[model samples]
Target: CLGKEVGADIPFCVYQKVARVRGIGDIVEPFKLKVGYDVLLIKPKQGVDTKIAFEILDLDKCPHPDINQVKKALINNEPLKDILGNSLLYSAEKLVPEILDIIKECKERGYEDVVMTGSGSTVFVLLEKGQDCRDLIKFMEGKYPFVYRTSILIK
Candidate 1:
């Protein structure tokens, strides 16, 4: 069970909802953050080992955004770019080359706020309301075998 052993963000991934997961992945506080967006999830051919990725991360160099500020951003419907500006995705990039490539491609395709999700080989791009994400999805599908157009499961 690497849930609590590996990292605190594991359980939050399982729920796929708005939450403030605390206490080393044991405590989950679900909250409502009224926001609307679509996500294009891209999983590249290469696999990234979480253990090795963790080994390479300099914990001191990661950006730790305040939970309250995140909540405020979500509730207030801040631009996706603004909300993800302080994400730790930058630190995790070097360990996952495939994910980084996808991020770069997404940016080139005019997508904003492309981020690697939770020790990932999978990266997601946020599409604001009314944006035509079909072209992005199609492009990713053509490039990668596993691409999903999904939404945040806010409950």
Candidate 2:
């Protein structure tokens, strides 16, 4: 959903609850602290450029640390601005609102923890317990078109 329009696909590793191993429809084992759901492992495409996965994102076109923009830029698949001279971002304050809005929306939707990953344009939320991330993806299928290439994010 989130990557459908962007061409990026969100490959998740789902684990169905072990307790409900005998059910046709999905069921929740609230008492189980670590209930497993169906699992789906998604690996990114190969040959992709180095991303902010575990690297620094130099986007302010300078030197500093605006982790948010770095994350956003990565999500947008924008080139990482090398921090050669100085300055981390050109106008981070101006762009922060957009990131905040994304985070806010996730919260409104009931995500317990939403964080901007590395110095990339991607914003992720680790939910406590509620709706499927797929539903959220379906909801955000349009807003970001550049994220589709994420399949190759760490390639």
Candidate 3:
């Protein structure tokens, strides 16, 4: 909202499903998504500071998932378990080790498409269509304070 009020060209700052940020300062380009997936969001009690995450990030050591491949997977309706990932996962996990635990737990429960969202304690598991998340939700709820079953935005 502030960006709009200031007459800034921040197209992907809000209400965007898939966006590519370039050259910093909210310079983003929105991409069209052909499909959406069922998502299970699990946030632990701890929180990560974005600033610190960036500070601790080592570009050489961090894993960078190919954004183009992710975009192609979404557009072609292909499985993204092997393609989609966040570069900030390494730093974020450093701040909150429980993030790794969450990922491990999700995988142990048969979830393959697990990834950390942004720079933090929340990990999302992409669920296959018609997959029930109740048991997972119940399991996560027993461990964490917030466990939500939701879907990714399509538009």
Candidate 4:
């Protein structure tokens, strides 16, 4: 309940499992999702205001991914690229150039579906099964102070 007032993503983060958030961030439905890979979280030097990001989001320039499709892909264990190709906060990249830079860098390094997590700054790239991200991490070592190899919490 506290998470709702703090941020929409917080509730989902607290659940730490596959979930479908509905009804203006009040409803959270947890479910089983067969996820096969971990995520690389890269935090840039800059940060963004969640309120400002939402306020300035341009639907035309930054498109929101279809939530149903994302849920279906996760449940079906689809290709990592297909399952995580889009981001709800992608449009916020326009407001924060650093976010866009990180996305571009991740793509150039063969990382797919690189998106800013939650509101800003922190970006995550999905790593496929058996794929090693050491090189990518090394590449980002000096550039970004916070880079973590992490997986979603399954409940």
Best by TM-score: 3
> Which ranges of candidate 1 are over 4 A from the true structure?
1-10, 13-16, 65-67, 85-92
How many clashes show up in model 2?
31
Per-candidate local distance difference test: 0.73, 0.36, 0.82, 0.74
Better of 3 and 4 by lDDT: 3
Candidate 1: tens digits of C-alpha lDDT, residues 38-120: 77889988666767777776768777666677677777777656456434455456665677788889999888778777667
Tell me each candidate's TM-score: 0.78, 0.33, 0.84, 0.82
Candidate 3 lDDT over 14-99, as tens digits, reads 75566666544356667876766788999999999888999999999988999888778877788888887899999999899999
lDDT of 1 at 62: 77
Better of 1 and 4 by lDDT: 4
Q: Rank the candidates by TM-score, best first.
A: 3, 4, 1, 2
The better candidate by TM-score, 1 or 2, is 1
CA error at residue 117 for candidate 2, angstroms: 0.9
Candidate 4 accuracy as lDDT: 0.74
Superposed Cα RMSD, model 1: 3.2
Clash count (model 4, backbone only):
0
TM-score of candidate 3 on Cα atoms, chains taken together: 0.84
Regions more than 4 Å wrong, model 4: 80-91
